[model samples]
Target: MTAPDLTRRLVAELVGTALLVTVVVGSGIAAQRLSPDDVGLQLLQNSTATVLGLTVLILLFGPVSGAHFNPVVSAADWLLGRRTRSGLSGAEVASYAAAQLVGGVLGAVLANVMFEVEVTRLATTERTGLPLWLGEVVATAGLVALIFALARTGRGALAAPAVGAYIGAAYWFTSSTSFANPAVTVGRVFSDSFAGIAPGSVAGFVLAQVVGGLVGVALVRYLHPEVGEAAGDVVVPHPETRSPS
Candidate 1:
């Protein structure tokens, strides 16, 4: 299959990340407004919207960019496929991360504006401590492990719903509400709402996520040693421009 142009793939990543953050932040705001007294109910509403929105976004963008709205996923793809030269090149990985980060920030701003909140306000929600950090680790590790497992086992077709389901479940199971993606974590810093994360906690969460991603890659290598070729299809198989090695 012919690969998509690099520009097009970047656009897909940017737009997909943007929409994903929009869903998360927007839903959080809506949930807050609708369930002013019940935190659990607000979380339920937010998670449900996120699950649905994420599934649709993946299905929509998977054909174009594999719908990897997470930087860790992109980095994992590169690390796993480096020896086989089947996944993204270093330059491509860098570009993908940049686009995702920018998209995440833009998405947050868009969500804030849509909700009539101040666009530049930083989040004040103080999410810190060992439990939260550990939660981030577990959440990110599981997410990476799941995505790669699906790719390795020829289950990429189920990624949309499967991934969305995992995130929804993690939201409740994890302590930090499962801020698994770094881009999304950073984006949340821009919104001081129910979904937001304070700037002080970003570093810890991001570090834990990175560690979790490495652990996830290790697990994939141990469990599916022979399926490295499928690394290019992480999240979902999409047209990819393999850079010159």
Candidate 2:
């Protein structure tokens, strides 16, 4: 099969990230409106929507771009595949990250507009602190580990549902509500809704995610020393990284 060109892959990343954020922020808004007084119920509703939406998005875009939609995942892919030359090049990783970031911001704006909220307003919800940062580390570590593990184990076909399920569960288990993606964290800064995180908190969350990504990479190396052999399949076997037949 022919690999997708860089432009097409980038577009897929952009569109996929945008839609993921839309589902996240849009559902949060809807959940707030539907269950105004019950924070627990609102979170449940939001998480459910996000899980289903994310799974669908991955299935939809995985063929074209691997449906990473997260900078951490892309970076991890590059790092793991560096020695084997099976993963993305550094330039491709950069492009993917950039596209995901732009898409994330656009998705947040779209969500705010749909919910009739202020689109340009920075989030006022403060989500900083030691516990939240720790939660982010744990959440991101587990996410990266799971993704690469599946790829290495020849279970890439299950990534969509597996990733979606892990994230949905992380929402309940993690203290920080698992804002594990840097791109999404930045995107959420554009809204003041229930899902938004204040701009002030973005740096801390991003740093934690990066640290978590490193930890995840370390774990995959320790547990699956040969993971590099399947690095091209991380998240899913998209055209960009699919092995040439």
TM-score of each model, paired residue for residue: 0.98, 0.97
Error of 2 at 224 (Å): 0.6
lDDT of each: 0.92, 0.93
lDDT of 1: 0.92
Error of 1 at 124 (Å): 0.5
Total clashes in model 1, counting residue pairs 3 or more apart in sequence or in different chains: 0
Q: List model 1 lDDT by residue over 1-245, tens digit each.
A: 88888898899999999999999999999999999999999999999999999999999988888899999999999999888887889899999999999999999999999999899789999999999999999999999999999999999889999999999999999998898999999999999999999999899999999999999999988999965688888788875457545
Candidate 2 residue lDDT tens string, 1-245: 77888899999999999999999999999999999999999999999999999999999999888889999999999999888888888899999999999999999999998989997689899999999999999999999999999999999999999999999999999999998999999999998999999988999999999999999999988999999878888688765463333
* lDDT (Cα, 0-100) at 80 in candidate 2: 94
- Model 2, global lDDT: 0.93
Extract clashing residue pairs from model 1. Answer: none
